[model samples]
Target: MASGQWRALAEQFQLICPSGGAPGVGSPGALPGLASCGHWVNVAGLQGWVQALLDQGIPSFRCPRCPESPWLWQELCKLGLFTDEARARLEAQILVQEGATGSYRQCPRCQRLVQRLEPGPLRTPCLPCSQQARRLYCFCWGCGRDWPDTSPHADPRCPLQAALHDAPKIQAPPSSLHGCPSLRACPRCYALLSHTLQGYPSVICPECHCVFCYRCLGLSGGHRLPCQIADRQLVCGREAVTLLPMGAQ
Candidate 1:
């Protein structure tokens, strides 16, 4: 459904949660709740709208009634619209679309989405896991193995450095992102992202709303010229000089 239509409906009617409770409450009967825009929205309808956006290849998720108000993943979780399973499914679909399954990983313990913000040691802490376990819990970001208790900084056995240095290159020859690292972190927020290689080398981070060139890792406004394709290689005004390393950034 179009966003405008959804917005109209949301503004006119009180939204009922399909799960039958106010947001963050465990009540069993349907209860109305306000969206971030202060408009009432049906939880089920809003979920469907988000799905439609993803299906249409639109990555950003914002309130239909208020486009300027973006929905963070955490907020969606609290609204009970995106359970762990549902969120995982949505993430899988995005990864498939971007051809970047390697760019993201799930926390080994809680299966929460996890990504390295900067080139760093293989051992990474999962906040959800730590919260649940009531202690610091870490796992290898590169190999997806549980972090050994013997070390605090680095994984003794994982070949994380080699994995980062030998990261895969974009394989889409017809696109301008070809030959660039398949994995990238948002230049502004350091959120993990991957390019589909179907359009311009630029992308908007769903997390921070930062528009940047995926190929050069530069803000869109900072680019002096558009990225180009030369000899089946991506040529940007500024080229990425290094891949993410295993050491801390």
Candidate 2:
């Protein structure tokens, strides 16, 4: 990326550390090539990181190979820091270390070796951590919101409903569910789950994981529905039932 573009991104994302801080400008022990501006970053495995960033909707960011430490990238790749190669290393290390401490080995994801605190063993990736760092690097473009997740309307500012309003829906093949009817969002509330209300106009949900047609949800409705995980469905002498198509039986 161009130096100007990098500066714009830094300004936009707040990536630069404050002066005199660890990554601050002109620090002697700072990463090579960053001594002058302090924004010099030695992101060795930055290509993969940048790809992940792009998948999350960050535009026009590039990870440049540090001419000096191109070998560092190769070293990280060989060590399998971001791949499953490190899993065996992590497992063996944990087995040796935790046994001495009188603890069983654990992998949080697999739970085979549960004592290792390393990121490779713990299944969850630290995307939220990276997003938090990105915020520190760049200025807020739109109103700040949580990073995107699996929700249909994941983009906080430009929701899926707004983006899909004008798109055409196609009919499905003969072997299909619901004949591929074009979905319509709630005109009032803007949700993907605006199906017709059949049984109860209001269902009292205890765990409150219910998503309903606008008519069946919200504060004025004065109703709550249990999440799928709730042990019991009934609350206050009423029970909430999920309504799916007859074929969904």
Return the top candidate by TM-score: 1
Quick one: best lDDT, which candidate?
Answer: 1
Q: What is the lDDT of candidate 1?
A: 0.55
- lDDT score at residue 140, model 2, on the 0-100 scale: 13
lDDT of 1 at 196: 73
Candidate 1 segments whose C-alpha is farther than 4 A from its true place: 1-42, 65-70, 81-88, 99-104, 114-128, 135-151, 155-249
Task: Give lDDT tens digits, candidate 2, residues 103-222.
Answer: 222322223322211212112222224344563121111112232333332334333422232122323333221121133333233344322233532323323444332222232233
In angstroms, how far off is 178's CA in candidate 1?
Answer: 2.8
Clashes of 2: 20
